[model samples]
Structure formats: structure tokens, C-alpha cells
Target: MNSEVILTCAVTGAGDTVGKNPNVPVTPKQIADDCIAAAKAGASVAHIHVRDPATGGVSHDPAHFREVMDRVRDSGVDIVMNITAGGGGDWIPDPADPTRGGPGTDIQTPAERHHPVGELLPELCTLDCGSLNFGDMVYVNPADWLREHARLVQAAGVKPELECFDLGHVWFARQLQQEGLIDADPLYQLCLGIPWGAEADTETMLAMRNKLPASAQWAAFGIGRQQMPMVAQSVLLGGHARVGLEDNLYLRKGVLASNAQLVEHAASLIENLGARVMTPARTRDHLELRGAQTGGEA
Candidate 1:
């Protein structure tokens, strides 16, 4: 394990998790509270994704994001905000007409996909590198779209975390790097265990990590039962770690967990492995991020 490992706590994701876990925060207030709790518990960064208050589904409402950010700021916690630009990519092709999209497919233009990041201007935002077949719906991000979003994020002065879900996605991200669309020493988040992406296993992660550029700052996460295993794997690989209810719901069998609990568990594991957990302040310094507006320390 690396001596200095940064731990990120992903707040409520934009999945259909509200019904699966009672602890998943839905409204802006609940989401903000969850993020604050995670930061207080020892998360260096909070990876956030908002949901609709009425339906508990994915939402791209900038107002909702504003509310969450305000609450987090008002709480005085020093968590590095890392919002998602990966939503609005789900595409369910119409069964009747394969050329058309079906219901539940919330595809948006590159500008719309990255609009929130431009408005929020967080220290960090994710830019998914490529599309993958996510079960029934295809998570689509063509190269042209990715290029546009990359430019927009770079222009906004926000660091883009290249989110690679598969091997090909990594290749695409490297292409962006070579094109100078990404910043120096780019950050990466390898999303493993999604339906058609890389498996959440040591070999798979090792392969991807070995393929990364020498100067990349990277983190890896797995979903469901693979989450904890990937945490240990990522740490051992000298990379950052992430955990939250967004990826996994249970701390143990039949035991639902809160975001803070998940982050605490990751912190403990990192500590037990003789690796120091970086606070949000340290993380900002390490990542070369501009300090938050409130000047809160991690």
C-alpha cells in the first residue's frame, strides 16, 4: 500500500437505490446532510450525484445541485466536492425501432451533460471516457461528445477525472490526454463491476493500472460485493480509494449502511494497512486543486 492514500466518499448516486436501501438520501437536504456526515467521518472528497425529490430518480437540475452545495458549505465541513458529469448518458434503444431511443433514455448533448460542472465549477468533476452497455440501457458517450465535454471542462478551470469503465475507455482517455484536452497529471477513476465493464478483480485492475500513464493520479472502485475487495486492491496498487452507499448498501449481510459508515470502514482499512488517509485539505494540496470558497480545511 502507498504511504499516502486519499479516501473519497461518494454521496448518494443517481441510481434506483432509494427503494433498495432506506438509508439512501433522496432530497437535496438529505443528500447534503449525507455528504457532510461523510466528510466529518473522514472522507477527503465527496463524489456527489443528485436525484429528483419527487421520483428519487436521476436529475440534472442545477438548482438541486445548488441546494446540496449550499448545505454542505453551510455545514462547515471541508470535503473536496467532486460532482458527476456521467449522468444523462443512459440510452435505451427502442425495441420497435432500433434506430430510436426508448423511454428512460435521458440522452443529452455534450454541452448539457457538462453544463452543471460549468455552472458549479467544482474543484473536480468526472468525464466518462466512453460508452458501455450497461445492462438494458447503453451508457453512450461517443468520442465527439467526449471531446466537446473535455474542452468545456478544461475551459471552466475544473479538473476532469477521466472515468474509464472499460479498457477501450482508457484508450479513449489517453487519446484525449495526447490531444492536450486534459490537464497535466490528470486524475482518473476506474469504475469496475458495472454490467459490461471491467471486472472488480485484482488482475483486471492491475492490467488497467499498468496501462496508465506514469503521471496519472488515479482511483478505482467496484460495486456491490466487489466494493470492499477493490478498496484493498486499489490501495495495494498505490492508488486512491472510494466508497459509499452509491456503490454498495450493506456493511455486512443483511446490514444496511450509511455513507459515513462506508467511508469510516475504508478509513479503518487504509489505516490498518499502514497507509495514511489524506484529509480533504491534504487531498486538495496533493491534487493541486484550488481551495474552496469557504476556505474550510480537511
Candidate 2:
């Protein structure tokens, strides 16, 4: 078992979860505050996604992202910020005309998806390696788009957390590394338990883990009720863990959990299994991440 682990808290995600859980942060202020609290509760990283405060819907607005980042940075917290570059890929086909997009469909060019990360210059940003049937819609991350996204993240001098939703994604991520699109020691996030993707189970996790490069650093997270189980499983398999409101909303069957509570609980599980969670400084050193930046500059 790995003795030291890095715990990442996905403070807010681009999901329809705001109405489901009152604790899900909607506004920029709430997201920033929750991220700060997660840091204090032993999370080394905070994965962020902005939302429309009024509608509680996903947003790719740079203004919202800037406010959240500014608040977190000004708060004197040392959490490693990881912004999502996997936005604007949702495609819901119109029932009447499959050729056209549905009302909720939001497809964007690689440039549009990379805008926030390119502008914010956070320590890390996600590079979703491949596309898959994401729930009811098709989350489109074509090979060309992924290559462009990887190049953008590389140019920004920000580490790309290659998010692999399936085994094929892991293979594509390795291909990106081989193409030299990703510069640093490649980091991967094995996203399991999502609908139409890899299931949240030991065999699936191990299968994906076995596909990683020898020098690659990786983490795993499961959605909903399997979140905690995947945490323990990932740690046992010599990988890092991620927990927060993004993937799981409840601490228990009927209990709605805050971001801090989720991080704290995950930390406890890590410690209980004879492992310790890494701090932000130690995580940065462990992953060889560059120092965080305020504005978007190389």
C-alpha cells in the first residue's frame, strides 16, 4: 500500500446537482469558500468548475472563474487549484432532428474550452483524454480536439491532469505523452462509475491502472455511493484519491455532506488504512508541479 497519498477535492462540478443537494456551491463566493475549507480539511488539491449563480447551470464564463480564483488566492490558502478544461463538450441530440443539437447541447471549439485555463494559469487543468457517452448526452472530446487541448495546456506551463473515463482514454493519454504534448511527469485521473463509462469496481480500476506508464502519477474517483469505496480501493492499489461534492453529494445514505466533510472523511479513511494524506506543498513536490499563478501568463 502507498504510505503517502494526495487527496484532491472537486469542490464544484458541471453537473445538475445543485438542486439535488443544498450544500453544492452555486455562486463563485460559495465555491471559493468551500475550496478553502477543503484545503483546511486536508485536501491537497481543489478541482473547480464554475456555474451560473442565478440558474445553477454550468458556465464557461471567465469572469466567474476569475472571481473564484481571486477569492481563493486572496484567502491565504495553499490549495493547488485544478480548473476543468473539459467543458463545452455536451451534445444532446434533438429528438425530432438528430442532425441538430438539442436545447441543452453545448458544444465548443477547443479554443473555447481552453479559454478559462489559458487565462487563469492555475497550477493544474484537466485534459479529458477521450469522449464517451456521458449519461444522457455525448461528451465529445475528439482525438484532434484532445491534441489541441493538450498543446494549449502545455503552452500555458500548467500540468494537465489527463482524465481517463475508460480504458481507451488511458491509452490515448499515453499516446499524448508519446507525442510530447504533455511535458511534465504525466498525471492521470481515472474517472470511474459514470454512466456509460467504466464501472466503479476493483477489476475495472485495476485494468485501467495497469495501462498507465511506469513513470505516470494517477488518482481515481467514483461517483455517488461508490465514492468512498473507490477511495480505499485506489489507495490500496497504490494510487491517490479524490472526494468531494462533485462526485458524491452524501456522506451517508441520507446525509448530505459539505465539501469539507467529504475531504475530512476521506482523510480519515486514508489514515485508517495506514497511509497519510499529502499537503499542498508536498503534493506539488511529489507531482513536480509548478507553483500556482494568479493571472494567465507563461
Candidate 3:
């Protein structure tokens, strides 16, 4: 019943979703426009991930991110930009060697993964808490690497959103907080329903929420069909909600959706739950986020 639930729209993920959904935005212009639409529809935050235009594959290119940032700023969307610093950690290890990596691995240094955040210095950025068996491949992020990344991101004056895929990851995030690697008013994104990660259900969400530090601020999102359900759950449980093409592509069964449509749906649900969606400016103030930079004057 609290009117404090902030809505975040993850425009397009770095997943293999472009081919699956025609509505998925590929170009920077399209992505920015989608983000603007989402903001218009009541999304307080816009989480971004750039892709390779040629293959529609995930990319860590800072130039692509720059293009997206420029376009979003130029559009004057009034949405908090939260860039992903979680890419470039994928590793498909060689079965034969076991030590060396195999092809299809987009392995890069932690610094490489954070290049966009370091350069652009968005109001918010993601810091994936732990490594996991992401499907068949291993998403590698050791503790040392994460500590270094936390230090670098904090130093850059960007608010780090701790993304935890499981309970153990949350534990690691707490360790980071205890070590003062992250700020006191830390933000967390509870990612559920991923392959081999936390399950998407009320019990799992409640358990994770209960474990969070008292000083921590957080949001919860579920993938696919559980996405909308978690929106209501998150709001009812005193947390924010996120939804969009990144987490889901369908507005309903067999119905394709644009990012704005997802935001609209989320807003309706929040309103139904007796909660009102906050604007980006309000969200920035609520989370104590640094103000965004004006690149192209949007």
C-alpha cells in the first residue's frame, strides 16, 4: 500500500533475444527511443546493455554504449540510466586443456567489463556479486576481481547496484558491504529464475529479502512468466520492481511486447496494488544517486 515502489524498465538485454522477438531494439536510436517510451509509460529507471549490430550478439564495446547514452540523453527521457558492468565475464572453458578457455568465451579483465561505466559514469551501474554456471558456460567473476571492480566503480562516483543471482551471491555482497567496498546505502537487484540460480517463487524471494542488511536498498525481478508476479510480490514486500524486454518479451501468452508496454503493465499492477510509480528524479533522490550527465542534452 506504500507509494514507494520504483519501476525500472530493462529495455533490451544482452541475451539471444533479438532473433526471438521482433520488438527487441537493436540500434542505439531504437534502444533510446524504447527507453524514452518506457519512461513516458512510468519507468523510473532504464537499465541498458548494448549489442553488436551485425550479429545481434552481446558486446562490451564502450563506443556502442556511448551511442546509446548519447541517444538517451538527447531524447530528454527523464529516466535514470543504469548501465551494466556485468558483461565480459563469460568463459567457456576448454574440456581438453581445462586451464585454457574455449571458443565462444567472451572473457576479459574486470576493468574491460567496467569500461563503459568508467567512461560514461552513469547514475547507476550493476555489479554482479558472484560467478555461476550460467547454462552450459561458466560466468566467471572471482572474489578478487569483484573487489577490484567494486573499488574502481565506487571511485568513479557511480552507484553500484549489487546483482545477486543466488543466496551465496548475497552473502558475498554482504561481505563487500562489510569491507566498506560499497557505500552504506547500497542498492541490490535480486535476480531470480535464471538457469541454475535462485528459483522464482514467493518463498525464495522472502528468504532473500530477509537476509538483506537493514541499510540496504533493493529491488526484485523474475524472468519470463514469473516477471509480473514478482512485480506485485516485490511491491507488497517493500521493494521496487523491474520488467522489460531484458526480463520478458511477452505482454501475455503469445503476445509480443515493446519496452514501454512492459512498463505500462508494471505501472498498472503497482497501481492496483495501491502503490504509485515514482519518477526518475524521485528515484535518484530516494536512492541518493548522483545526478546523470548530459551528453547530447536529452
Candidate 4:
């Protein structure tokens, strides 16, 4: 069991969850406030995704990101900022014309997807390792696109959290490392329990964990009801954990939870399991994220 664990809270994801849970932060102010609260509740990092305040839909607007960063930095909370670089990859085919994109499709080039990260320069940013059928939509992150994304993240001096949703993603991550596209001693996030991806069972987590590079640092999270279970499972298997409204909305069945509440609950579980949650300073040292104490740009 890993005694020193880094708990990351994915504050607001790009999902159709705002209407589902009232606690999901919509505006920049709300997202920044919850991130601060998550830090106070023992989260070492905050994984952020911006949304259109007017419509509560996912957005890649740099203005949204800038405002959120300004608020979080000005709040004086010492939390590692992890921005999502995995947006603009959603593709839903049209029923009438399968060759063209559907109404929900929002695909983007590597440059467009990397804009926020490149402009803002957060401590960490996500680089999804491969493509997979995410729910009913195809979440495309081809190997060539991934290489370009990795290079961009590397050039920005930010650590790329390789988000692997399946075993093949893990394999491709190793390939990226071999090709020297990834600069740091690779950091990974095992994203499990999403529809048609890896399962959220203990055996599956173990199988994926076993494939990680010997020197790599990794974390794991499950979606919906399996969130807390995977937190415990990840800790037991010597990996870090993630929790927030992004993956699971309810603190328990029938109880809608805020992002801070989820972090608190995950911290409690970590401590109860004979492990401890790492603070922001310790997490930065552990992950080797350079200049983390300096904070992000406004």
C-alpha cells in the first residue's frame, strides 16, 4: 500500500452534468471557488475544465480559462493546477450523412486543443494517449495527434498526465515515452469505468497498474458509483487517487455533492486505509512538477 498519496479533484468536467447536479460549477467564479475549497479539503491538485456560463456547455475559450486561473491564483490557495487539453475531440456521426459530423460533434486540430495549455502554462495538463469509444461518442486522440500534443506540452514546460482509458492506451503511452515525446518521468491517470473503456473492477486496475513504466508515477479514478471504490483500490495497489464532481456527482446514493465534499470523503478514505494524502508542496516534489510553488499566470 502507498502511504504517501496525491489526491486530485477534477473540479468541473465537460459533460452534460450541470443540469443533472446543481453543485456542478458553471461560471468561472464558481469553478475557482470550488477548486480552492477542494484544496482546503486536502486535494493536492485541481483538474479544471471550463464551461459556457450562459448555456452550461463545454467550452475551449481561452477567456474562460484565463478568468478561472485569475480567480484561483488570486484566492491564494496553493494547489497544483491541471488543465484539460483533451477537449475538442468529440465526434458524433450524422445519421443522414455518416461521412459528416453530427450536431454534437466538436472536433479540433492539435493546435486548437493545445491553445489553452500553451497560452496559460499551467503546472500540469492532460494528454490523452489514445482514441476510444467514449459512451456513444468517439473520443478521438490518434497517435499522431498525441505526439503533437505531447510535444506542445513539453515545450510549454508543463507535465503531461497521460490519461489511459484502456490497456492499448497504456501500450501507446510507453511508445510515446520511447519516442521521447514525453519529457518528464511520465505521469499517468488510469481513467476507468467509462462506457466501453476499461472496467472499474479491482482486477482491471491491477492489470493496468502492472503495465506502467517502473519509474512512472500514476493515479486512478472511476466514474459514477465506482468512484470511491476505485479510490480505495488505487491506494491499495500503490497508486494515487482522484475524486470530484467530474467523475461522480453524488456523495452517496440520492445525495448530490459538491467538489469539496468529494475530496473530503476521498481524504477520509485514504487516511482510514492507513495512507495519507499529500499536500500541494509534497505533491509537487513527488511529481517533480517544476516551479509549482510559483503559481500559474493570471
What would the TM-scores of all predictions be?
0.97, 0.97, 0.95, 0.97
Residue-by-residue lDDT tens digits, candidate 3, 22-97: 9898887788888889989989999999888888888888898889889888876688999999998888888888
Whole-model Cα lDDT of every candidate shown, in order: 0.89, 0.93, 0.89, 0.93
**Number of backbone clashes in candidate 4:** 0
**Superior by TM-score: candidate 3 or candidate 4:** 4
- Superposed by TM-score, candidate 2 places the C-alpha of residue 219 at a distance from the truth, in angstroms, of 0.1
lDDT of 1 by residue, 74-120 (tens): 98887889888988998888889988998888988989988888998
Model 1 is weakest, by summed lDDT over 10 consecutive residues, at: 289-298
Better of 1 and 4 by TM-score: 4
Please list the residue runs of candidate 2 whose C-alpha ends up more than 4 Å from where it truly belongs after superposition. Answer: 292-298
Cα deviation at 126, candidate 4, in Å, is 0.3
Candidate 4: C-alpha lDDT = 0.93
lDDT assessment of candidate 3? 0.89
RMSD of 2: 3.4
Off by over 4 Å in 4: 292-298
RMSD to the hidden true structure, all candidates:
2.0, 3.4, 3.2, 2.7
- Candidate 1 stretches greater than 4 Å from native: 292-298
